[model samples]
Target: MRTIEEIKGRCFITEDGHWLWKGALRPDGRANIYAPDYTRWQGDMRTQCGTRAVWHCMHRKPVPEGYRVFGTCTEKACCNPAHVRCASEEDFGLWMRKNGNYKGKTNRILANRAIGRKRSVFTQESIAYIQTSDKTGRALARELGVSEASVSKARRGDIVVFAGAAGGMFSGLIQRGAA
Candidate 1:
């Protein structure tokens, strides 16, 4: 177990009272809490976030069941105890929504597709609509809010190979059971 003094030494208190972790950072810029034995979060090989580490140190215990420790401060790397709190995922979403950060962006296209209200760039239905609309690529591009090149590539089947979950929402090449 790492000592509290060691952990504190790896961080510095900012002018605004945020404890910025001077260690590893996740891809999203959140602090990565490093501890030898404290691995395997929810059965995944992952380190805790720094804010969660600060809360654990302050409470001298693991986070309670059915609750997640989240940062209240704007600094995602902040490990200040006063800046962290435990909440259910739903409550966390509500808090983020109240703070104007959720915006229904996560899995938004999936949710919309589930509800039959697709809000993204292209679908099979849209591609069929464009193919049968008798409009030029530029006109279809304007109608679909995409580029003319995308319309042309979509027509030529050049965009299908790149159409997957993370990106490539420009054509009707998306298939189910993709990444």
Candidate 2:
């Protein structure tokens, strides 16, 4: 494994104290580090992110399990210990929420459902009708002003718009003859 000094040598410090990595970068632009015989379980060689290696070097220990090392600076290539911090999944979610870049899981699901509803030609009433009706796909499509493929999907529950229980919205609204 490379030493902290070797890692530092691979970066050039910016005026603002960011150590921009000059080594291999991931497709997403994060820095990558190749370490040989780094972990016993991972065999003779293992590839890791530069930030993670730097964090391990500075802290004298590996990041805790279920924790991630992230750069606090805007520069994705930076591996400066001062510019990086370790966070758990929950902590990261909280930070993302605080930064207005995240919505809670439930809220995100609800928002996505709303968006799908808006873009879809089928409504709650139509979806229930499609599921329960004995009508043919072509007939249902013509009646609902949608394509036969859509009606078929709805009948197969591929498009779920029913109310009540999990994975659905508008609870207590689906019923026989509701349409």
Candidate 3:
């Protein structure tokens, strides 16, 4: 059986250009199983960030010792040796929760998919209306039914806020007032 040291070579990129870390090795000199949905989360894994770190699900497991891991959130391929740590099953969960990178998923899934609860149902337009009209992202988020950060993103142009302002409305209003 091949060991992780042998798997240290690079893996092929997917059609979308995402890199996979296929070089994981087991402690007993066996080739670690590699899957397409592999997760590489970065953090201090040794302390069990909070809850039971061991995910008993069939899909996930703890990373092997001495292997460089990265945060799926940053998407940075950096393998800084100092960033690595050995985590207990519980510590890993705490780190994921406190850092808001729970389960190696991006913020989009946590918010849109509602890993814990129901998702917000506001569109960009709703956020823009709240921001411009109410002049408060927090309040607008409340009124628009989304996160304050989402409202801020809409204002900052991170997300497309459809333009609904019309010059005709101003002109018509001016004409009516004059009459």
- Give the candidate number with the greatest lDDT: 2
Question: Per-residue alpha-carbon lDDT of model 3 for 1-179, expressed as tens digits?
Answer: 12222222443344544333344434532223332222344422232211112121122454554432333223232112223344655666677678876555655543443422223344455644654684677777776677888777777655532223222323324533532
Kindly list the per-residue Cα lDDT of model 2 for residues 1-179, writing each as its tens digit. Answer: 36667777889988899888898899988889765322232333467777776765666555677887777777889988788888997997777667655455777767776666557676678788888998889988888889998888878766655343344445325533354
Report lDDT (CA) for all predictions: 0.67, 0.72, 0.40
What's each prediction's clash count? 0, 0, 20
TM-score rank order: 2, 1, 3
Model 1 Cα shift for residue 64 (angstroms): 2.7
Model 2 segments more than 4 A misplaced:
36-45, 101-179
Error of 3 at 76 (Å): 22
Q: In model 2, how large is the Cα lDDT of residue 112?
A: 75
lDDT of 2 at 90: 90
* Better TM-score candidate (1, 3): 1
For residue 148, model 3's alpha carbon misses the true position, in angstroms, by 4.4
Which 10 consecutive residues of model 3 have the lowest summed lDDT?
A: 48-57
